[model samples]
Target: MKITKLETVIPRDIMPGLLALRIHTDAGHIGHGETYYVPEAVASTIHDWMAKRLLGANPLEIESHWRFLYERTTNFGSRGCELRAISAIDLALWDILGQVCDQPVWQLLGGRSQDKIPVYNSSAGPSYAGKSNEPHDSHVWPGHGCVGHEGPLNDYWSVVNRPTEYVQELLDEGYRAVKMWTLDFAAHKHGGPLYLSKQDLEVGLRPMRAIRDAFGNQIEIMLDGHGFFQLPTAVRIAKAMREIDPLWLEDVIRPDCVDTIADFRRQTDVPLAVSEMMIGMEDYRLVLEKRAADYIMIDPTWVGGISQTHRICNMAQSYNVPVVMHDCTGPLTLLSGLQVGTATTNVAWQETVRSQIRMIYPKLISGTIQVEAGYAHASDEPGIGGRWLPELFEGSTYQHRVSEAGR
Candidate 1:
């Protein structure tokens, strides 16, 4: 069928957040996709810019449509907002294609490598304050197995006062892997910059070391440097944490400098994880081609949806590099990433923020994502298996300032 309409909806949220696109065809089927960006205003900017080209194109020609959008926006640059827009449209097209063919998106990509892909708790443990409490508050837990089946507790609780207690809690919950932000964002105030200082590095690795010592190698620990350091400092910190033996060091340096990433990779023995901020195939290509990272990370919302993610994963597989899908956003993002993970053979693991799980699970339309023994299983359902619930957006507010043409 031919394309007839393209619609965008930006769900109002705490930060400039998730933008959803609905692509309608003459045959009356609509596909769904989402693009994640910031300044909150970029959503509307991208929506309007892409609308001009997408209005009457053939929705099924996913590759051609992707290229047209990419070339048309070359002058605007391809890294951030433009790529994010492309991602949303590309994803919606995949959704439409799946609906038309009567198959799950994963099957369309290629059959599943495994029925369920193993998932890691990307953001479990303590909160930013370093509190010992569970990653989520009381309101967030909707009860175990509410979505489909009972899964392990994958929460990202922050403990401000008791760091040791936090580690104990996760181990007690039967969680084998957990990720925590070591350097304090607020701690940057004490130093001239936000990066870890010599003292900061000592302080930061203490908790990680303690957790490792307490739990031993049986537990896989991950650290989020949060792009808080320059390349040199990042290398130093990664080297320092080598003793801790982290599963991966995440987004340690800014994504802008490919050369710097290469430099960091050369200096550190730790497996570097990059690309939480990347938006499309070009960004993924740069990271892969440069050999800049041991593990490539892509958020489906930010990185041109399921179709592009599949392409990127295939490329990574050729390089013998594994991919870890990033999921620090809402539920739609989690489900979207799940579709890609199931179809990908080289995916290392999928990231999940237990703190946001409670807020996101209710939005699912069908099937269930059951987590067992630290792995996630996708439902045998069509589409992404999720729906946009009006109640989730009840108190949410969004501001859209699209150019007349973009609108």
Candidate 2:
């Protein structure tokens, strides 16, 4: 079926960085996709540029459409919003393919590799959802510094202030792993990532040490540095983290230089999970080639959606390195990760912010994501599983942009 229209909606009141994309086809199938951060720019790319390549094209030709968009954008630098826009469109195309074939996305991607995958909790609160009213700069940076109330699911705040209690709660709830960004505060306090004092380093390690003291080996601890540290500081953090024996240190430094990451990895005993910041396959290829990361993190939405995610996962598999799906962004992002994570044999963990899943996700999407114990099951439903709620587009505060074929 030919694609007839492409539409995007950004919620102005809540979750402002979220952009919900819909591809309408002549065959009555409407495929849904979404990407987080920079909604206005992503929406513009979808309508003003990417829409022309998609309109009137065969909706099921997912690969051709993906390639066409990628090739054109790379000539002009394809990262950030451009690649994110392509990622949303790629997801929509796959969703349409799943619907047309009457199969779930996981099944369409070579059936299930596993029944379920283990999930790791990331310390995030409801405020992590997005900033209200602000369309741009919607991402919430870590470290509230005693700002908000101690509500349930406000794990980010709790983790720093009440580390022992937070670990106990997650352990009681069946989570085997938990990730935090407590070091970010030090990075900002030090004026930059260039330096970290002995005092601040001790402060940063306190929560992590508390978790190990209280729960010991009961829960796996992962530290996210938010790509904020320079080499010397990142090395120091990694060296200190060795005491706790974390599951992995993720993005302790940026993934900008594979050679530098390789250098860092050589210096530390702590296993490093490289990054989700790598935009596409080419970025990932270098990471794999350099042997930089012990585990590779891929954000399905940010890494060009399911198509590129699958390719990267396989490439990592070739290196015998496990894949971890990154999804602290949005529901479609989490759902898209599940679809591919369940189908990829080497995938190790799927990251989840329980706060976002329970507090923010239900407001925007229509279906429930099944997570029992610590394992998440892929949706058996066709086309990316959950659809964005019709009411999400009905609000007066929601902004809509569209591109129709032959316009």
Candidate 3:
């Protein structure tokens, strides 16, 4: 069916300003997709920049549409919001394809290779949801894209006090893997340069030591560096953590510095996982070519949707490197990526904010993502598997709705 209209809705209560797009077909079928976390930039890119090209196009020609947009945007700021809009649209097209075909998206993705996706708790704290209103204004979780400060009053990490106790609680709730920021935006919080003191280093290490001591071999601990360190400092922390033996160290060095990442890999045996912020294949190519990281972390929403994620996972498989889909952002990203995980053999873990998702998901969409003992099942419904329940947005002043006649 031809795509007749493209609509965008900015939910007033949910994220206040983030954009969610719906692709409308002549057959009256609709598919939903969400772009990057930042609302204004992505909204403009989708509503004003890209919608004109999409109107009346064949919704089923996913690959052709994706390539057409990619080739044209090369000279027109190809990366940031531009790529994110393409990502949102690509995801929605796949959703429309599944609906028309009467099959779940994962089955269309080449059937399930996994029954459920292995998961790791984002450990962003007990109250990580709805903070998207102030999105980057967090007191416990590390920020995405750039470093963000956490206010002193609700420093959830400190509130937990005992790291093992914090982790054991997750284990008790049925999580086998756990990930948290060991050092992040500390420079912003401390009002100093990006150097960590002896005391500062120990403070970060305390949680690692606690988990290692408590579980030994039962739980896997992953550390998030949030691109917080220089190469030397990153190497030092990697060296120190080698004593505790983490599953992998993530985004330890600024992901842009390919040479520094290579250097860190050479200096220590600590397994490396790079940023989900990487949008270009060459950025990932450099890491894989140099054997810089043991794992590739991809956020389909940031990198261009299911199509790009499938290509990246295939590339990683050729290198014998594993792929993990990141979740600490939007539900569409999480749900779509998890569906990919069900079909992608090279995938290892899917990140989840347990407290955030279990409560918020039912309110926003029709499908249920059930998690049991550290693993999550993919949605079985046809299409992209999510049917948006619109009534939830009934009366919110902050909401903005735009249709293809043009917002």
RMSD of each: 6.6, 2.3, 3.5
RMSD of 1: 6.6
Candidate order, lDDT descending = 2, 3, 1
Report the C-alpha lDDT of model 3 over 1-407, residue by residue, as the tens digit: 68888766665455433467788988988878877566777877777767777887889999998998888889866788888888889889989988888988889989999999899887663234344333453444424322223432222453136567667777887988888775664534553125666676786778778888878878888888877677877877887888778889998877888878988999999999986967888789988998889999998877888888888988998999999998766678888888888888989999887655765556567767667899988788777777667774355453554646433
lDDT of 2 by residue, 1-407 (tens): 79999989997565877899989999999999988888899999999988888899999889998889999998998998998998899898899999998899999999999999999999987777654221222233533232255776888778888999888888888899999988877776635589888789898899999999888898999999888888999998988888989999999888899899999999998999978998878888898898899999999888898999999999999999999999888899999999999899999999999888888888888888766788999999888998888877664467887799988
Winner by lDDT: 2
Which segments of model 2 are wrong by more than 4 Å? 132-147
Better of 1 and 2 by TM-score: 2
Worst 10 residues of 2 by lDDT: 131-140
TM-score of each: 0.82, 0.96, 0.90
Per-residue alpha-carbon lDDT of model 1 for 188-305, expressed as tens digits? 4444134556776776677778877776886788887666568767877788888999888887777888878888998888988887766667777888889999988888877766
Residue-level lDDT for 229 in candidate 1:
66
In order, what lDDT does every prediction score?
Answer: 0.66, 0.87, 0.76
